[model samples]
Target chain A: MMVAEAQINNNTINLLEGWEEGLDKAPEWVQSFRKKAADDVMKTGLPTPAWEDWKYTNLRNLESVTLCEASSLHVVPNISSPFIDLKPIIVQLFNGSFVGEMPDLPDGLMIAPINEVWTNDWFKGFVSSLSIDTPMEALNSAFLNDGIVIKVSENTKIAEPLLLLSTYENSKDMLSVMPRIVIILENNAELNIVEHQSGIGSYVCNQATSINLGEKSKLGHYILQDNDRTQGYLFNTTKLNCYDDAVYDGFSLNHGAKLSRHEIFADLLGERIECIINGAYNLISTQHHDTTIKTGHFSPNSISKQIYKGVINHEASAVFQGRICVHNDAQGTDGHQLNRTLLLSEKAEFNAKPELKIYADDVKCSHGVTSGDLNDEELFYLRSRGIPEIEAKQILTKAFVAEVIEGIKDSVVRDIFLSISIEEGTK
Target chain B: MRAQLGRKKESNYKMIKIKDLHASIDGKEVLKGLSLEIPKGEVHAIMGPNGSGKSTLSYVLSGKEGYEITSGSISFDGHDVTNMMPEERAALGMFLAFQYPVEIPGVTTINFLRTAINSLRKARGEEEMDAISFLKLQKARTAELGVTMDMLKRGLNVGFSGGEKKRNEVLQLVMLEPRFAVLDETDSGLDIDALKVVSKGINSLRSAERSFLVITHYQRLLDYIKPDVVHVLADGVIQKTGGAELALELEKHGYAEFEKNQSNGAVA
Candidate 1:
């Protein structure tokens, strides 16, 4: 395995100099957080195949490309909503920097760019609360280019979902961006958040979302990342902390980008918490997508479900690794995972690894995986009924991934995802 | 005279005429020197024991994969159709009800039927069925086939009972309304009631303008279908051609005598 310590160290040192120059914009502690996080990342470096978790995904290509840091100068690219009829509440970000215009938000909702509200006591306390760090989480905090914070007050149920769109406009250079997000829902509050990424040029989008759900609160987090550039890179890390009787639903669809990975972690800290994490990847030629999910059941009587479906097209590859860990005292835990892959061509490949580490005796956990190309009998059955081969392929492929798409609770968002993914498959 | 002319209208040349079809799967020959013809207004039943190549003959005509016809000619409605795709043959009004209807997960039965009918309509240069008309058409046929409304919303034949699967196939037969239909072992795993329902569905489509080729191992389905002509197939060729009485005779006596005769003929 090639070491990326030197490659990452150079970028971290350069970013530190930039952070010191803008010390007033950020507080003293934010600067220290950046420096300390950078040092931690420099020590650990990028993950290689030697690590069991990163076995199938290679980071050699990512480490070799020394992309430039994001500049403050922002230019909004012309991006229309893919869902024409759905005028969702939109929060736009350019190159990891917020485009701070005002939109009318409902009561009990507060959304502001983290940099603009860094001095608030809640922001400072929430930012400095966590101490333990993983390599990717440290890397995100070290070179944090921009961030957002959304706090929903207690007993509020928002009607419309908030869409946070981070677009990397026509890049003059190969840029690298790290966007951080923190969402906190108070007791009995409910909120749905959708994170979207779109761009036209070569760049690396590395971001982390940390969510905290108070007692009886509900949260749904969705990530839709589409980058068609062959050399682009996108990696997202989403972590959720759930309290008693809270519900958390996280879903992601990695439909574009030459290389992309979404790592999701959920911690069920209180009883009766239920979380469902489902995802799908529609990959094309020479593209690689990896989805890694882990859920820890720390309290008794919690439920966790993970389901993923991927279609690997010609010369494309995908990987799914899911693990459920039940602690010793976490009895009555139920965890189920199902991973399915459809190889669209002879050259496409899909690999799945599902694991369960349970130290409790009264837990129920199971995992299963299936992967293959379209069934010949099914195709012939359709063709024998008068459907042309082209249309037959489209129908069968769409049907193959429909089970996962139907997992999304919202009908409008479901329709948009369905159309985009089917369009991508047909092409 | 009017009824006769009505039958003659669709039988421009013939409903189906297959000559000397020699087919194989995976280098193993299944059909050798098989020939048959069906007129527009007749129902033909081909009965044979196991491995007698009855299903292979149906598959070759329907253009299924893995059944390669080395030397043959298949004519459908006067047009040579040996090289056509499955969809093309279907567009020409050829339908095959599979012995094992494929269980396609996530495809609703109603959606599948609509797509199939529209594609065929498009091929025939006819206007596609609108949603309202399609719903009416579907509800009427599904009600007759004893298919519940809930089954239409579920995946096509997935997790269905064997009787439900056969009913679904018959429902497709009712919806497609092809010029010629091939029912391959439609009564294989059916009970008496299911068989009656399926046979009723098939009987409803009987007309002077349509023909059927019922392939079965036993004479039970032939009893319900009442074919106009019956052929005893053994070793890939028709050993005997007779009226519907041939089915009763075969039901009384097993296929052991026919196998001996075919082997003796080959030896001679």
Candidate 2:
């Protein structure tokens, strides 16, 4: 391990040496977090196949490439298909650094840089209470320059969603972007958020998002990552802390990037709390996508349901690993998880591992996963009806993905997601 | 005899002709040079016992995969349809209702029907149907078929009872208004009430321009729809063809004699 770290450090010394100049401008707390995170990252290093959680995704290529701190480029921002019609407070992060334009946010909503929050005593204390065990989270905290910090006021309802857009524009340089976002919804407050991360060229985007929900609060969160064909690595971890009677609905659609990993952890702390995680990913060519979600039921009468659907075409690959941990004290817990995959081509691959760790025997918990191709009888029936083979396949694929997309309550976002999925599926 | 000959001439104007069809699956022959013609403006029932290639004929005519047509020719409305794809056959106004309708988990029946209708219309060089007109037409057809609007809104055949799936297939036939339909054991799992409803829907779609090839193992469905001709499929061949009484006769006599004749032919 020591020799490996030494080799990695020697190979990536040029990538790690440039941050000293930027440290002078960062806040004191940001500098301290970065130092600790850099040290932890050096000790832990990039994950290997030996790690159980990352066994399917190989990060050896990521270690070989020397990463450079991404800077603000002069490229114009392109808004192709806006998923929703809400007038969101847009906070744009271009290549890991904040682009200095902040939209007029609603009253009681705080949209500021992460470093700015580190300076504030209240938010600093709030973040200190949350767990940050993963090395990626530590790295994000350490290198965090300008990421969005959303603070919703107590009992306030936000009419529009908050849009956090992370774009990668500079491909001429090998870039590493570590973006951090923290959203805190107060008691009885209602909010909707859309996080969009996309890049044009080969880049490494490591993002960490933490969401905290107060008592009786309702939140709808959407994550859309559609990047270019260039080799890209994305590490996203979303943590949700729910209090009593709070309801959280999260939908994630990952359609791009060469290799992507999404980790979500939901801690149901309060009684009567309900959380729904719905996701869909479509992979083609040689792309690889992996999603790992864990929901911990700490309090009694908490319910969480997860459904993840994926379609892998050509030689692409996908992985879905979901775990539901119900504590002994958490009685009357009703948790169900289902992962279904449609392999469009024989060469494509899908792997699903659903685990249920229940300490309470009284709880109702179940999980099922199925991987298969389109049904021959169904295809024949459609063909017999005079529908062409391609059209039949398109219809079947659309139907397979519709259930997950329809889980999104927002019509505009659902429509956009469905249209994009259909367009990409046919292509 | 002269009236029968004239009726045959008129049937030739609009009918599907299957000439000495031979189809196999995984090298096991199912349809062994079986041949039959279903004339327009009439309903024909093909009743057979288990392992009698009743479903094979339906699949082969629909151009389903895995069923290799070793030697056969199928013509629909004067066009050679042996090599046509499923959608092409559907665009030609041909429909097949499977005994076990597939469960499309996420797609709503309404959306699927609209897409199928529009696809067929587009293939025929016709403009797309607007949502309002499509819904209006669907409402009338579904109401006649006794299908609730909620059924149409749900995922196609997902969580639907057996009878509901059969009725939904009939609803599609009514909506698409196909010129020819092959209903393969549509009444297999349906009870008497559902059978009557489904049969009524099929009966309403009957016309001089449309034809039906109803495939079933029981004679009960024939009692409801009444076929112009009844054929017995035995050992991958049509062993006998007669009027509606033949169904009642086969139902009472069973297919033992036909099976014996098939084995004798094999031995010869």
In DockQ terms, which candidate is top? Answer: 1
Per-residue lDDT for A179-241 in model 2, tens only?
778889999998888877777777777788888999999988987887774477777878889
Q: What stretches of model 2 exceed 4 Å from their correct place?
A: A1-17, A64-66, A73-76, A87-89, A97-101, A409-412, A422-427, B1-11, B251-268
Q: Candidate 1 — which residues are off by over 4 angstroms?
A: A1-21, A63-66, A69-78, A82-87, A423-427, B1-13, B125-127, B259-268
* Cα lDDT computed for each candidate against the true fold: 0.82, 0.81
lDDT of each residue in B1-268, candidate 1, tens digit only: 3244333545344689989988888877777888899888688999988778888888888999988889988999988998889999999999999999989887899899999999999999999999999999998998899999889988999889999999999999999999999999999899999999999999888878888999998999987888888998888888889999999999999788778745422210
Q: What interface RMSD do all candidates show, one decimal each?
A: 0.5, 1.6
Q: Least accurate stretch of 10 residues (summed lDDT) in model 1 chain B?
A: B259-268
Docking class of 2: medium
Cα lDDT for residue B266, model 1?
27
In the order shown, the candidates' DockQ scores are 0.82, 0.63
